[model samples]
Target: MKQDVQPLIVNVKRYTLVRNLVFGWLTVVLFAGFLLNFPKINILEHTARNLYFHVPMWFTMMAAAFVSGYHSLKVLQTGDPLRDIRALQAARIGTFFGILGLSTGIVWSRFTWYVGTDVWWNFDPRQIMVSIQLLIYGGYFVLRSAFDEPNRRAKISAVFNLFAMTALPFLLYVIPRQMESLHPGAEGNPAFSQITHPVMRLVFYPAIIGFIGLFWVLYTQRVRVAWLKYRVTQDSEM
Candidate 1:
């Protein structure tokens, strides 16, 4: 019992350190995001501010998916129930970021490109592919609930989580770029760096790091809580 409790103690200490650091870092990013000056392009003008907020959401989602995939791989190797918990938490958080990314993109696009029109969604390739990606992860959560046995659920869900991770990059980046898209890096559109001002990159990079750190903090908290519940109930679903 002491051995088990000891690991939890160490985890708590580490989590506390990271949580505080991420909070401070993100606070700074938020301030810089709004306060810093950016070059105004036609159409994008003020909405260019979204580069710091919107782009980071997808970056955070990618980071979360990577973390989830690593844990899922561990689950396959060690059959550790805790790995399943981590995978689930990471995927859930990743999905949250995906949703934010989609929402922000819609708002940004509506005002910038569809100002005179009533279009909220134009069925852009990136938008369609990302929506499908989110649905794939949605299936992962739903699949977990179908099994009553803990080990079986963990094993099966871990497999599905891996598949979801595999599909992420292609759906979010590759396929979207292959067809016509208003988004940067897509067919005929300039890549991000080509259109974005150098000054914006300063905030953009840190914003990515800050959002990913935020994801880690949230994911770790959920894992700790779920672990506690699992220990007490001997059930991995919390």
Candidate 2:
């Protein structure tokens, strides 16, 4: 007799209330901090409100990319095709959040630049490289779907994902510092200003945590859905 394997369940029911309580408390603290301290920033003033959404978007993007790279590494080591699918979903979702982050940052820029002071888009190397990073993953999805052979798709994507992960550090940190820009922390900029404010920290930290948690939830769901579909297709073929 053949043994039946159970599908994975991606839930933590025992800690449901605890997680909710923590998330609620953090959300309240972030909102309160933002309400109280937002006026102090001269650059954006009221427009600084974008920080709540903008920063969180970036955090989620990083989380997604990290998850993608992790699964890619696992697939390479273990030769598990499911891990490759999970990694692809992470890249797809992460890119969505990255684009959202870029859009929100641009809106904030427009408010600060005060119209006509600069172009709508700049040729900054960081921006250009990050955009290319986005396209690289976009092509990844297309390439994966183009092949009917699971083994070939997984191997090719794993190699490409490893290469793409290297660009992340450059795009997120290094290249930004090399150029002049309207964005903060540019051109050898060093300031404790953003990180040191207690009120801002209250909001920023939770926002980061909340966004990361949210990404995990979404990624888990995507994997479950894809796994189910894969099982169904296999059954029908049999």
Candidate 3:
């Protein structure tokens, strides 16, 4: 009994520590993101400030994909229900970040690039690819719900999750760059490093770390809640 309780206590303590640390770290990133001075450029003027926020959303999504993929792989090997919970939570958070990224990109583009045209989405290659990527993950959730059995759902969804993860890099980064895009890093367009200022990098790097930390905190919190529900109801679907 003591041995079992000891692991729970340790997990509680570690979760508390990470929770507090991420909260404080993100607070700093928020302030630094706004306070840091950046060089001004035409059309992108103040919107350039979004570099600290908008870009990190995709980065966090990528991190979440990798985490979800790892857990899916474990579920295949160990057939652990807990691993399914982790994978589901991670994918959910990743989708959330992707939505945020798309929304922010729309807002940024409307204000800066499409000011007169009233166009919210220009069907940019990167934009289209990211939308497709989100749809793929959406299918993962749908696939999970198609099954009534816990073990069966976990097994099938884990396979689909792996395929989704495999397509993420290609959709989000590779194919986007090969096509014509308003976004940076497209064919003939300057990469981020070429256009970003040194001062912005200071905040940009920390912002990525902070947002990924935020993802972890949220993901872990969901896992704990799902695990508790599983224990009480004997239903892993929660």
Question: Which digits, one per residue and each the tens of the lDDT, describe model 1 over residues 64-97?
Answer: 9999999999999999888988999999999999
C-alpha TM-scores of all predictions: 0.96, 0.84, 0.96
lDDT of 1 at 93: 95
What tens digits encode model 2's per-residue C-alpha lDDT throughout 120-227?
666665567668778877777777777777777788788788777767767876777677755567775554375345656657677777777767666666776777
Model-by-model lDDT, in order? 0.91, 0.71, 0.91
- Model 2 residue runs over 4 Å out of place are 1-5, 12-30, 116-119, 192-196, 234-238
Local error of candidate 3 at residue 195 (angstroms): 0.8
Q: What lDDT score goes with residue 10 in model 3?
A: 26
Scored against the true structure, residue 134 in model 3 reaches a CA lDDT of: 99
